[model samples]
Target chain A: MLRINTRSVQILGQQISHRRLSELSLLIFMMPALVLVIAFVIVPAAWAILISFTNQSLIGPNARNFSFIGLENYVRLFNDPGFWNSLGTSFIFVFGSAFLGQFVIGFSLALLLKYAGVLSRGIVGGSVLLAWVIPEIVAVYIWASVLNFQSGSANQILLAFGLEKQRWLIDMPLLSIIIVNIWRGTAFTMLLFSAALEAIPDTLYDAASVDGASRWERFRYITLPLIRYTILLDFILITMGTFSVFGMVFAMTGGGPLGRSEIIGVYIYRNAFEYREIGYGSAASVVMLIINLTLALVYLRFTRVEWSAEA
Target chain B: MHRSGNSLLLRLSEYGFYLPILVFFFGPISWLVLASINSDPGSAWQIPEQVTLNNYLQLVTESDLLLWMGNSTTLAVGTMTVTVILATLAAYPLSRVPFPGKGVFMYALLLARVMPITAVIIPIFSLSVQLNLVNTFTGAILILSAMQLPISLWIMKSFVDSIPIELEESAWLDGCNRLTGLIRIVFPLMSPGVAVTGLFAFLAAWGDFLIPLIILRSPTTFPIAMGLYRAFGDQGSVDFGFLTALSVLYSVPSILLYLFARQYLVKGMTAGSVKM
Candidate 1:
């Protein structure tokens, strides 16, 4: 019995060492990715957080002798009307373009495609995707031209019906961006929902219809519940994406006539680079990060419930 | 006859519903095309009396358009190569090998994805200045690849997970090691996933505007996005024809790539969400 125990112990020790060897090798394999991510993303993010507590500037007297001023920038941010306005604009943009416009329209289109023939699906899907695949700068330029004050295609169409031409960018800056964002972004939501919709078995719908269910009833009971997770996922992704949008809005309006179109991203850029207030900008960035993290946490909690229920 | 007539009416209504969407989607692109070729810039909205390609010619010859295209190509290709190689290497072990703190590592990748570039730009900008890496292709490539790593890793990990372990184990029994087994067996199986991930990385790097706008100040170093923005700033509202022409030229590469690789793109895009 003693000899057998010793042999078993030796085998177990070898097995454990082999496993450790493999783990070490795996770590080595992961080294490059880990190094790059740490160097570029993790380090810089930490540095930015630190800088947020200081009175740093890109230029002027503070450029040479900036000192720590803990929480002052955050306090200034809370009192600053510009920061508040930008936050408000961000929420409006996210709600308008992401929630109401993209989600509703894209899901509706996906539902519409379910009933349509293949030819119709191909054409409609292709068209919407064209807007999505074009580079952001190019898309912005195209939309800018279409919304040009005079001789623009939009005004031309409006005037053809004898409606007065309004200065789109100036008169309704936020709305114009919201519309353009909807156009550019709907395709992603459409595709996501389309994939989700296709996953539901047709037998469920067939059985419902056989039982004398109405179209609306079938959708309400069967489709929405089936796609609830997908809708949550899309909400989280699109909200984050739209919140980070800068190039599109910048090119379209440069945050516009008064800062009416200045979302958080543009606001940060304007402060950091344009106004040379690095510390103030970092403070805004920290706030933006916190808000995003909070939103994600709330949505993640909802998703967790869904996950547990499904499991 | 009554059922057929009902079906026909349904189909007609569906087509009608699609009309507005189609027009909205295509109208701007069609207008840009028209403006690009129109001889008379003043009558941009009207039918052209004569078609011309002078605007495109001038864009290539007079401006820094070609140089920007070169820069964009280098950035995109470099990003794709680095992202694919590093992501695949990292993903293979994460999927196949179990380790302590693995869950934490995976969560970190997700957190990285959630963190916006805007939040970190200040420090990254200052750091790049300190390192004297501003305006360098290597700097853009490194940052872009890092930014792209999380998604690429996620996608590749899923792909690697889908592959059966027995295949590699059999290769091991045949006197091959893990690296060789991976190269010989797993890579071919995951080629589609790799292609999709690479395509996405390319798209991200190519379409990036803000990074290059911040980092590359010299005209010769500008990517297409910065170049087009500079062009727009220079011309403003004075020359719609030139602007439209540049926009068309700028859009062609990405549009063509999308059309070519859409199947992979869509599959890769939804892989993470659907799996979750």
Candidate 2:
């Protein structure tokens, strides 16, 4: 499949058949990355998956010491009411933060920027990214103060307006995390949609306008369809990102008030580190992996990257 | 694309559109600054009747704040450098070379990036322990680099792909290997992307909290995040003033970084999203 170079015709164009040598050099270049990935990411991951089927403890030295308990861990997981609750909480967090929250705000912001003139777009986009660039833990701290029940800035603002203080974190844990996540993450969605929106040819919109389409009609027919691929991409990426969230929740609430915000990450962290149930924790991770892969596969099936090839 | 002449209604709607944005986004950051400056923690959390520099002074005087800052900067810079280099080399073949099993390799890297880091934390932690890398700056960097490689690689591959293949073809015909072509030609064009992705990787490594908390058990190796969280949360008595001050300081470096690299970061993030 290599294209013949016309200019090289005059010269003695050599066929470089040193494929093995090239492959070896490539492997040499790739060795460090491959080794680290395999040792840290792959080996441990595979070990954890295998451990999920066994009764391994944190104190155990060898992988062999643990008895292969078959699918008991999985069966126990099914019987555990707390696991289901955690799963439900994880779903709520993902949907609340990623899908319904960031998606709507980010998509709208992109639309607003698209309609606005260049100066406005630059200012809004730049300002939004300011928040996005801040460290997530720092963001969590800032929001934690804002969500403080008594003396926090949120209640202070509410009190300034002569309204009752809302306990953002305590009264509503899931909603609080959702809002904070949206605040931290919407910039990403906005950036994606903005790029997609800008790529839409202006003539298409002009054509729609000439056809007497209302602003909403043009947006519905032209804007949404054009950026649908980007939107799907955003949805999938955000889903994965938010599903794995731990830092923000840890910094803000630490899965508090009776583990109300205990998503799987916190749950597994507690299981492994706190309770020393390393085997159970590995089992939980395996479950999480299954969930994430299933979701990713479903997204790929639905979006079908080929559909966006023309775009 | 039609531009309606400026009308009173249109101008009114502009204000309408901007109002909510200002309220939601600007309000919290403004409050954070205000709270950080106020002398009294309780009243600072409330409407600050007065402001002072004590919160900042208290933060600087109370702890190893400078050391934490240095740690974060070092870690971010290190992680960025490693991530960019490895990702670039990995991305080149995936984007350009029509090698067999390329699709599978690309998918593997993608899955690694998009998969939950929390899911891998225990495994990574256990591995780090085995390697005797736990609590070291290098260990944290390694984890961050691995965690960040997937997205950085994906972004980099797309950027490389968009470069015209003919340019590389000519270099290849001229007896230059792939590395030479990449170094002298492709790298210059791809530098913008490299800068952006590096910044992102740095930010991710810098911003991370859980990895440091889980792996770095020693207090001396604590990043600013771990330092502040432990200082604020673990202490029997809470010091809101110190927490606010630390948070403000943490926010400043990252904001300064963004301001310096905003152009590259913006372009990088948007262009990188094309495939995601």
Candidate 3:
């Protein structure tokens, strides 16, 4: 029923040098995904760099016909105080949410959950994960009302405790967004660390105890060293993820309260879409891209080290 | 007796440490749930005098909730189909066949996954405009699928790696072509991998807000996420019932998927990070 010419290349009960899949078919198989990514991701990323030199507008005569304006947008961005403020806000956000809040709390939760009762793990771990799986807008909605001015749960709790109500989004916008981000993100690190912890054998801990090592000493000597790669990978992923957060802050504060909570993502949207300054926005995005690429390169290095060590 | 007392204290401290975290995480989510059923919901978390289904009913009868949900489902399904098909196709070759620069190509994919989507919005927007793909579900689906391709490929490649090549080789010995062997034997065995990839793609495209906001202009094309964002942003007179109900509706699919993929989440997250 089928052609046997290709099969002639392979004899029955005899070994072939390699599998019979052809190179042409493999290339054909890869073409669709390769085209999609190159057309969308790689092309757009490179185009952002090219357009950063132009005086493009979202609408107007310039939209149809724009001329190159080298370094003008970048020069203006570097000179502006607002851009500096946005950059600073973004770093604080990444540092606070990814490093201080999520990493510490998630790591602690994982460590505790290892020895925790079933009930405690069910309640605590369940809540953290529920926060994560909900849509970003839903998280934004929940937090917006939670930090509402007059009738928020936060205020009600404060009043019930006889403390003055603080304006969360307005008075302390930075801290507010940071708290929201940490709440949404802590689940990932917790899961990652829990799996890593579970993989380590009980014998390692038993050996440490037999050597008379203290709890802290055992963690330092064994746990940290074993999970170091996981820790590095987690940092790389979360940091980039946090850097790209836009919709939550965009809907909540619009990077307002006098631009106090304007992260870089919101700033790009504001400049490009809201203000119709595509060229300027492109310049800002180029800076953010550089930062992300740098992080990715560092990630590659760590992973490469692991790959070579495996060999 | 002394050792027993010390162990009891240790247990007490462990629960004590967990108590605050549980409270911090659950308090707000509990409020969201409670507010949804309250007849007259407010910002403050409180029990309603009597529970009512009026909010959910209003969403079904009055608003464009169904339309938005329909659009969201279309986008999600489209994305899932495209991402899964392409990823599976690409992964088969990568798993079995050796190609030039394969290692470099894999690392490039890792970079693509971590590259910030927000940073490339300008060109993506303009490209869509040029292609006349603006405001089209096809455009949005294509873009979303591209975004999800990197990690999905890794997941699929690893899955394909687990299925021994001998099974396929044996099929070939029976005069089966590679495509037929794949469709008949290999795919059935890798359904779990396909499910994982499909689930991730669905969750992503369903819950995404940014792509819809940029691509779609009309309310007719809005997804549930866009609806939720618009309703909640109306500061004139807050519709707590409707907003809370929509939130519940919006999260249902995600929560269902999470429940289904509970065992796979850890594996899914580490797919690209861990060496195969």
Candidate 4:
């Protein structure tokens, strides 16, 4: 009885000590992530917010020389033609590329895959997967070549068909960028929709089929409602994802042919990196954060979604 | 004949759906392949003279393309290592422990994920400059690792959630400490998740452009994305053959990496979809 009692006490003591150790180690382990957030994310974000109210330039020697200007930067931004044009351009690019393209294509493809035999599904799925697998920069290179004006493969194919060889980059910059974005990004939608579709029991489809529902009917009634939340989730994620995209636009159009394809990301990049308007750039970034957060919030509100379900 | 017509229409639509996807998807890649092998440089934008390996050959013999590849590999592997370690440690408790503000921490990470890198580029730029880490491999790797950690943590946390707590408890009853139980029992089951998370982190760091573009101005430290951008823009007109060759070469490792890790991705992503 004494031996057993001693063993129980030892186990209790060890458990207490281990719990304390876990707590200490947890703090130590969490430090790197915590410090990184403070240094790169939290502090920088705070700095960005503060600097937005200042009149700083890319040429400034330090952030100290920048004087506080209350809302002038934002006031100027609201009145600036470039900012307005960029905001409009941003809406077009984001909705056209992200919302309309990826969502429709992703949803439709999911429907097709659901009905498609396993073999066709793999083939179709794998082909889309190839585009996703290739790096965004590489995708840009491929599309850039295809969209070439004078001697592009696109022109060659058009010429072979006796069609006029139009200037893809110059004539349709926004459309060109949108198409490339769609090409590169559809895979994400495809993957997400596939999982979302699987969450739907096959029995629903069988029930719809037995009711003599046509493919379109079933899709309209059954598939669409079921994946509505997934679609909304996909929308928010893709919208935010596309908002921040740079490499594709930078490569395919350089936000140009007279800045026709200039989304907010490329616009901010030019202001910050190219023109050296550090403070102005930070202001633009601050605006971007606001827009994104608002979108995410709006998304959560409409869909009644919470991100903490642990998948 | 009526049934035959219906079947034919169905088949045609099936083919039709695939046709656009195929043409849009494969058309560019096929052109890339042809351009990568074309003999004349400008011929890539035009009709190809003939298929040749000269472009690929030129990449190796002429430039620091190989060095860029090496740097990408190092950064990717390094980011994967640090991210897996850090994310796993943090995620374990976030998954298991009933800590206060776990939701806040999780939300903060998500917010970090969505906040564009461009937004924070200036402050990060200033900080990196102050640290004298501009154009350093270590700096790039550190930033990339940190950038990728939030997403990795979310994914791995879900993976950990799938394992029953009883498994850990049983191990503890066998006289194992929490760390030991995590290392010995839990980690083995979580290997698939780790592999996928590592692959995602590796690809993200490997293919990233903007960070490298701003941070590493030197040609010596360029990743493939930046290198391709430079090759395209440095000249008045794009260098089609060389760019295509470089793209093809760059894609090889990632494609291989994908094939090796494809199984893990579905699992990882399903686990990750919780946050979505």
Candidate 5:
């Protein structure tokens, strides 16, 4: 009995060592990705935070000799009306396109497609996806041409209706970008909601109907409750994405006609590359990061509360 | 009879709802195609007196469009390959191994996705300069892969998690090691996920405008997006015909990719949204 007990203990020790070796091997597997992320994302982001406190520049006198300015850039950022204006513009852009436009229209489209025939589904799905699949630059160009002052198709259509041609990009640049963004982004929301809606069992709706519930009531009680998580997820993603939307707006209006469409992203790029104020740009970026992080935290908290309540 | 009529009305309203969407989505693209072929450059919206392929011919002959496309393809393929391999390697351990600080790694991935690219571009730029990697395809690929890695890792990890570990364990029982099991047993099942991840990585790297814009200085290394932007800048408001033609050509690959992989693309893209 004593010999058996000693033998079993030796076997347990071997098992422990084997597990440790495997764990170490697993760490090896994780090393490449960890190195890449740390090298590229983590390190650069940390450096950006450091650079924000200093007077860095891409060109001019500060290019060679830059020193730490210690919150001066942040102070300048707060006092700058352009920064405030860009933030306001970002808010409006996010609210208008992502929240109001994409959510409403995409949800409506998803609900519509739910009942539509196969042919309509194919056509509508294909058409909406075309907008999404095309490159951002190409989409911007398409919109640019369509909204051009002289020979734009939009004005042509208006002319056919005996209406006046409006200078879209010049007169109402912000509104124009909002509309363009809505057009570009609604497809994603639609696809997301469509998938969510599909996951809802039809049996619930049938039971609700049998219980004398109206279509709206059924949707409110059953569909809404079931897909609330999906809606939240969509809102979080689209908000963050729209907040950083640069390429399309830049290509279309260059955030122009007096910075009317200068969203935060465009503001950062303009400061960083065009004006060559790398430090100020980094400051703005840091602020933007804070805003995004706050938004993410808020949503995460909301989801957590929701999940805990359910549990 | 009333229910049937109600259903008909619903269908008609659905069609009505679809009309505007169809127009909104397709109108710009259709107009672009029409304008590309229109003989008169001055009036892009006008009915063409004669449709011509001259614009396309001019684009190819006058510009370095082909070269730019080649560069774009190389950047995209390189980014996709690197991102996939790294993501897969990392995802396996993440899914299978029990380690302290695992949650930290996951959160780091999430934070990477949440943080805007602008937040890091400055340091990345300066770092690239310091490393003397500026204007190189390697630099662009590295940066793009890094930017795309978090999402790819998240996606690949989800895929790996969905796969049963029991299958791998069964392989282990068959006298196979973990690496061997992953390669032979797990990889085959994860192909769908990998394919989707690859497609996304390819699309993202292919369509990226900002990273390439900053990193690549030489015109020779310009991707299609940069090439188009340069062409637009050079030509300005004139040459609508050539510009539209270039736009159409620029859109062809992505459009073709969408047409081919719409099902997988939709499924894969939405999978993360719903799951998360």
Candidate 6:
């Protein structure tokens, strides 16, 4: 078989072995990466499931010799109000940041950039993208200062307007994080929508205009349909992304003022790392894995269709 | 990519719309730049009467900021090297060789790429402990590189796919074996791909907080990210000057890289689907 055996063969005036080499070389090249993925990503994902059923801990005897306790961790997680609160907070975070904030703004920015001058496009796009490119901690620091109660930029602006300076992080923890996430994240959707929009030939829009379609009609008929898949893909990616945001919230609010902003990542961190309840944390992680995997499956299948359509 | 019928009024309206947006988008980060040089930095924004380098100097001279940055650099460079080498090796065959289960393999990679790292951190922590990789740069680098490899491999494969197969074949007829041809013919062309892939791997490793947080326990081993978090955490007396300066310093490399790679960023994030 050509798959493995590299016997003398010509296919369409090209030698397969010359380009692809033997299967031995294939194994040699792929083995290192495969081994790494297995060790880090694949094994740990499976092991988290195994650890979820046990009483593992970061400290004490259970750290090493932890035994299975059979569904107790899951049962406790279900009943625990903290876990429930964390899930609700996660949904709010994802919905607020991904749907309300990033998607809406990013889409608008993309649409605006489609017709804007080059300078406007560069500056606007660059500013939005700058927020994204910085490290997560830097983003947290920027927002923390901006929302700092006494001398923060937001408070200063409020005072300048002769208004009260509300305790932004303390009183509105969830909203604060949502705003920060939006600031940091909108660039992705903007870039995505921009690419999708650019691919839509202007001729279609002009033709629609000539056919007496209004602006909204042109957008609804041509633009929306063209970018529907991108919207779906963006949703899946940003949801998964925002849902796993640990560092930003962790560094900014510590998910704090009483778990008010404790998204799932912070929740898992609280349990596993902070509380040292490895088993309980692993249980939460299993749930997180399942949700993300389901989304990833949809992503893969959706992208497959998209790619095939392109071909 | 251009469209007709941009009336002057419409173009003016577009610029008008961008005013508030530019303010909103650009407003927050001004704190970082301002506070770092403000002689009397505070939580609130203030334009200083006198700009001072005291904060930057103190950080460089007094604190372990340099050490933390060095560790971060070490991790980033190590991760970049490991990831780029492995990704390029795998990508070469993946693009050319037709094999059984290749489709499944690629899908598995996509799955890995998208799976939440939060879901598996607990186990990864334990794995590091067992392997005696805890508090070690080797562990951090390997984990970060592995985490990056799924997408890096995908990106490199797409890059390879973009290269003409005929070139390799033509080189094959020139008395050069695969290695020489790859280095002589393919590699020169592949350097840009390598650069893009390596840059991303470096960025991911540099910006990562969770792995370093859980795996590296000691302050001595902390990256600038963890260091910034700790410096800000002594909540009672948080040093605004130090924290702001550190944030600015930590951000410079990533921002520079972004400016350099902004053109490629869209295609890269989209997983090499778009042609540049």
Tens-place lDDT per residue, model 4, B27-92, is 777778777888876523444778799898888998888888888888889889988888777767
Per-residue lDDT tens digits for candidate 4, residues A1-311, read 43555765566576876676674565455677667666777788898888888777666564558788888878877887777777788889889988888878877787788778888788778777788888888887777768778777778778989999979989998988888888888878888888777878889989989999997898799878877777777788788888888877877787887778888878777887788877777788789889988875655454322345331
The DockQ of each candidate is: 0.47, 0.43, 0.59, 0.48, 0.48, 0.52
Whose DockQ is higher: candidate 1's or candidate 6's? 6
Order of all candidates by lDDT, from best down to worst?
A: 3, 6, 1, 5, 4, 2
Model 6 clashing residue pairs (backbone): A151-B43, A151-B44, A152-B44
Report the Cα lDDT for residue A306, model 1. Answer: 17
**lDDT of every model, 2 decimals:** 0.83, 0.75, 0.88, 0.78, 0.81, 0.85
Candidate 5: Cα lDDT at B21: 86
Model 1 chain A: ten consecutive residues of lowest lDDT: A302-311
Candidate 3 residue lDDT tens string, A183-213: 9999999999999999989999999999999
**Model 5 stretches with alpha carbons more than 4 Å out:** A1-17, A301-311, B1-4, B41-43, B46-49, B235-237, B264-276
TM-score of candidate 1's chain B against its reference? 0.91
Question: Which structure is stronger by TM-score: 4 or 5?
Answer: 5
Best by DockQ: 3
**Fnat of model 2, as a fraction:** 0.39
lDDT of 5: 0.81
Question: Each candidate's TM vs. the true structure?
Answer: 0.92, 0.89, 0.95, 0.91, 0.92, 0.92
Instruction: Give a tens-digit lDDT track for model 2, residues A86-203.
Output: 8998899999989887888888888788778778776676667766887787787777767778677678878889999997877788888888888888888887787778788999
Model 3: DockQ score = 0.59
Winner on lDDT between 1 and 5 is: 1
Measured with DockQ on alpha carbons, how good is candidate 1? Answer: 0.47
Better of 3 and 4 by DockQ: 3
True A-B contacts kept by model 1: 0.52
Residue A126, candidate 4: how far off, in angstroms? Answer: 2.3
Per residue, candidate 1 scores C-alpha lDDT tens digits across B131-234 of 88899988899999999998788789878888988687667656566678888998899887778788888988999898898888888899989988877776
